[model samples]
Target: MSARGSVTAGRARSSSRDSILDSAGRLFGERGYSSVTVRDIASAAGVSAALVMKLYGSKEKLFAVAKPTEALLTDLDVPVSELGAALVFCVLMRRERGLREPWAMMPCTIQDTPRPEATRAKTRERYLAGTAGLMKDTTPDLRYASTVVALMTGFGEAVRTLGLFDGWDFDELVAHYAAIVQAQIDACQLAGQD
Candidate 1:
């Protein structure tokens, strides 16, 4: 191929890859890993099954690429006193920007996937442990960290997945919920000092 043709082909390939990843993420999020087949993802992506295989090699590989790997509350640069607002704002803004909430999909994955145990383990490792690690400076108790994770997950589900407070003013909602999260952190810190 000529230089120009090669560049065009590369762009087309990149587009196709992105489409495949988007479709895979949506399908896996909706139907869980085992329920979604390579062909299902390919059809959703508007590409042939052969192309998906050629690109990702297998359904598992595709899912690994498509799945959300980052923890929801990874940014801890803010002062510990302001962490709750920072974390809540980060999650809310991400949802507003249409980013996937991995925790929102946890219940479905645990119930629907072929390997529920694996899903549970991954969830604990990715979310619970990761969030707990961030909370270590505030509290040594894993239980407190776990509760914070649960609260955040439930709050995210309510706001994003269920649309519980759709019409509420964004700033008011953030402040209100941030207080609840902040209270938990405060309690954890107090307990740690004792």
Candidate 2:
């Protein structure tokens, strides 16, 4: 084949792969990780199941391409300089939505698979490392930022398991969570020797 032909084929292949991954992401986000299949992704992307299998190798491989860890990173509402706060906020929001989030779901994804699990570990580590210093600043409130994120995540899961989401309003819940954080920060600043 000519160079032009090769280039065209490459472009088509990339587009198809992108579509497959995109579809997979949406489906995974909507349905839990275990429930989504390669065929589901392929059909959503308008491609053949064989193509999905060939491209990603298996259902797990498909997740490797479409998973939400980095996607959450991209959606964080923080600046590069204030990554800790951004990460904290991101974790809070995700936890508010419960573990159905990329964080919780990714763990579920790796729960059984023998595939490389390092990426999953690294992601969780990165968030903790990223938020370490900022979370430590809660003297008045003592660990307010850090505690909020941790509790927020745990609360979501606990509530979801208990089927409590139906009665909750996110805005009110976030406000309630924020109040806890503010009290911590205030306690810290007030304890200063000034």
C-alpha lDDT of residue 28 in model 2: 65
Question: Where does the lowest 10-residue lDDT sum fall in candidate 2?
Answer: 79-88
Tens digit per residue, CA lDDT, model 1, 14-132: 99999999888766544346668989989988999999999999987887788522335563545668767766765665565467766676777787989999888787767766666
Best by TM-score: 1
Backbone atom clashes (below 3 Å) for every candidate = 0, 6
Error in Å for residue 177 of model 2: 19
> Which candidate tops lDDT?
1
Write one digit per residue (lDDT tens) for candidate 2, span 40-116.
88898999999998888988877766743333443343333344333334444445434355444444555655664
Query: What TM-score would candidate 2 get against the native?
Result: 0.39
Each candidate structure's TM-score, on Cα atoms with residue i matched to residue i, is 0.58, 0.39
